[model samples]
Target: MQETLFCLRVGHRLPYSMSYSNTTDFTNPSTFILLGIPGLEAAHVWLSIPFCTMYVAAVLGNFTILFIVKREPRLHAPMYYFICMLAITDLVLSTSMLPKMLSIFWFNSREIDFSACLTQMYFIHCFSVMESGILVAMAFDRYIAICDPLKHSTTLANPMVAKIGLAVVLRSAMLILPYPLLTRQWPYCKSNIIPDTHCMHIAVVKLACADTRISSYYGLFVLFCVKGLDMFFVALSYTQILRAIFRLPTKDARLKTFGTCSSHLFSILAFFIPALFSSLTYRFGQNVPLHFRVLIGNVNLLVPPMLNPITYGVRTKQIRDRLHQLFSHKDI
Candidate 1:
């Protein structure tokens, strides 16, 4: 008993704690301490300002998109349905981490229970995957709209979009289900201090006292297979879309048609660029600063949710008109 207590106390300070033995069961930690951002703890308070701003914007913007879509009868269409799904995905993704991040930064409440940490990790990745899938679905919507205009309504009906949204949700959940289960089996004999804002699969798995090759390889597989395939489809769809757009005889016609896709394209960039950058930084950026990597990871979730609604609001004619009418003290 005394030895167990000694080990537990020492585990809090050291990165690698007592080695796992065949006879011992070392599964869960009571609580994991989030260090916010290692090597930049002094700046956490100031850093909370931008983080807080992004969270607030994400909440309001996504909620506004949902509200506008729900209330406006004319806005009920396949495209808007997809946008609503994306909004919900973004809200969950950002909400999973940002509030806890703010707590860590502002109030210094950094301890996350094991189950809660796993839940956060699952929600973050699951919704992230859902967002990527939704983006691909949006790309396909754009493809059918531009490439096969006559068949667009028939081919991508509201029912079909709803089905696609369901598929996205199911696929995301199933893919991420293994993450927490695998993490739970691992023995976390290392220090409980997570040097980032929230629990990530790789971050948590790395603390395991046992071999984590399975977890690492599985994470990479999901990243490359699921997200990679989603990216490929988006690219292919856009390729066909651009081809169709350029085929329009008049310049004005082509520009007008292409303008419809501008928001989705920006949203794709906003989501994937930072996600890829952060993933690469985490995996291969050994020389990169830890704080920068954590910040980039946070930005990956934060910026997209905050930007998506704004992008769609300003770009979509129906949405823009409704917003102006709703907020201009005019009858919506």
Candidate 2:
């Protein structure tokens, strides 16, 4: 059985304690201290440098994509519009975690206030949902273009695309809003250590004095409904897209369409596969090595932002050509 000991305010500190005999047990402790960056004491400088480098790269890369889409009139289309939305989402996603992560690594301050921690969790989930929606929109765009070429323009006109984008943002925001709000309402005892680097939703909920059975069930339901459904839609879209491609009269046209969607396919895989593993690891495999768990966690958070621009730029010839032209002109 599990027990929660909530310590009321006594001066500026509160005391909370929990003990776990096995990995499956959540009732064992109310709070576990998060030891950020496992080998921090001995080689703090070495660890901080790489983290900072990745943060900068993630920011710059995502912003560059955003700028190119906004400034270039020729690149204005439904496809690039969705790409811009994705770039913006990645920017927010990275910003949500990187600043605090950098501070923790450089200054060795892992003490995050309860309010700020919940806020971070909110933005993280919000942007994550936004990214998933954008990918689904992109897949739908591809499906219309490949499967219904004659009506592609009529089906995905500017006005229709704008509405779709707005709907995506609104729906995602609504889906994730409840999670953070519910998490913040739970009182935290003095023992406020988190096992992971960031304030993960599951880890935070486990600290609550109130029963978290409803929260956990709601979270799993939301996870399956959002991520799982989006992935299934993407797969279904590609199935029709592939079928249409094979039916094409000419080989060149099939290859051209394939090239257009290749980046999206790569990005979809990169984002979802690591996320699936991270979720499974947290839910089922607590005994796994902490470093390995952390590595998977980072992959879900960092890899998507870093890979988005590279994958899109490489696969989309127009973006690649524009980048080349910009660099070549700068050399002169």
Candidate 3:
């Protein structure tokens, strides 16, 4: 009776279905059905409204940062350069996930082709790593400016800074390119249902029937090597920056130092805290609630892009003032 029901629900035979079976045998499943967003049905307009709003806001916020940095002559500096890179990264990163997510929400058609899935995974990883590298570059720039003020011009001169920026882009691109290629090569015999909305490395990997030990190791290695190392450098740079700030003679100078580092620090925490939680959840999957997992995953993807511009605008007087001036001039 159970077998009959399973076959009926699966729409023919168990072998062609993407649904998972309780039995030990894993060979029956072909594709995976992503249990779309927890409580929101695909056709619910109300549920998708918030996601649409976020997507629009994320794009506009980051794009405005890019525009301001490009148009404002005063913003044409090492700091803004890194910020623009960050904005660009956020734009690409959010874009890679949001459209597909919205489609799933609005249409209820969560059936992403295998190739599309791979492409989405590739870009998501690429832009995410790029954001991490750009943040590290921003921290390093602050470190040099605070710790070595006299040589700031020489240390971060146009040619040198440009080269560094290029290197950051190149490194992130190369590091993330291998994962998609490797995953696509593996044979997938298990159910294709990706539990999450987006194509995450862990969720996609877990769908494989073959041993994913190597892929898991690779994911860990990249996490530690890229995100972990970037965090370490950011911490060290901030430590030196703090020491330098304390040595400043005037209260104004001290305040200036704090103001300069504050945004970067906030941005760092925003990016890392959720990431650490996601990694922890990934490692120990048993006890966590599904909704919490979904929430964390969405935050991990969304917050960095949205918070980045806000952080800079709030913390940097120059950016804030420039924004005001730009809007005021446009009003005239």
Candidate structures ordered by lDDT, highest first: 1, 3, 2
Question: Model 1, 1-332: lDDT tens per residue?
Answer: 33344334423222233222312445788777787877677788999899889989989998999999999999899999999999999999999999899898888887899999999999999999999999999999999999999999999987888899899999999999999999998887655657789999888987788999998998999889989999999999999999999999999999999999999999999998899888878888999987789989998989999999999999999999989887987875
TM-score of decoy 3: 0.88
**Model 3 steric clash pairs:** 18-31, 31-192, 32-192, 32-193, 33-193
Candidate 2 wrong stretches, greater than 4 Å: 1-34, 39-44, 330-332
For model 1 the TM-score comes to 0.93
Lowest summed-lDDT stretch of 10 residues in model 3?
10-19
Best by TM-score: 1
In candidate 3, how many Å is residue 199 off?
Answer: 0.5
Residue range 5-44, candidate 2, lDDT tens digits = 2111111122232222212333323333444545333454
Runs in model 1 deviating more than 4 A are 1-25
lDDT-wise, the better of 1 and 3 is 1
TM per candidate comes to: 0.93, 0.86, 0.88
lDDT of each: 0.88, 0.76, 0.77
Question: Would you list the clashing residue pairs of candidate 2?
Answer: 14-190, 16-190, 18-29, 19-28, 32-193, 33-193, 34-194
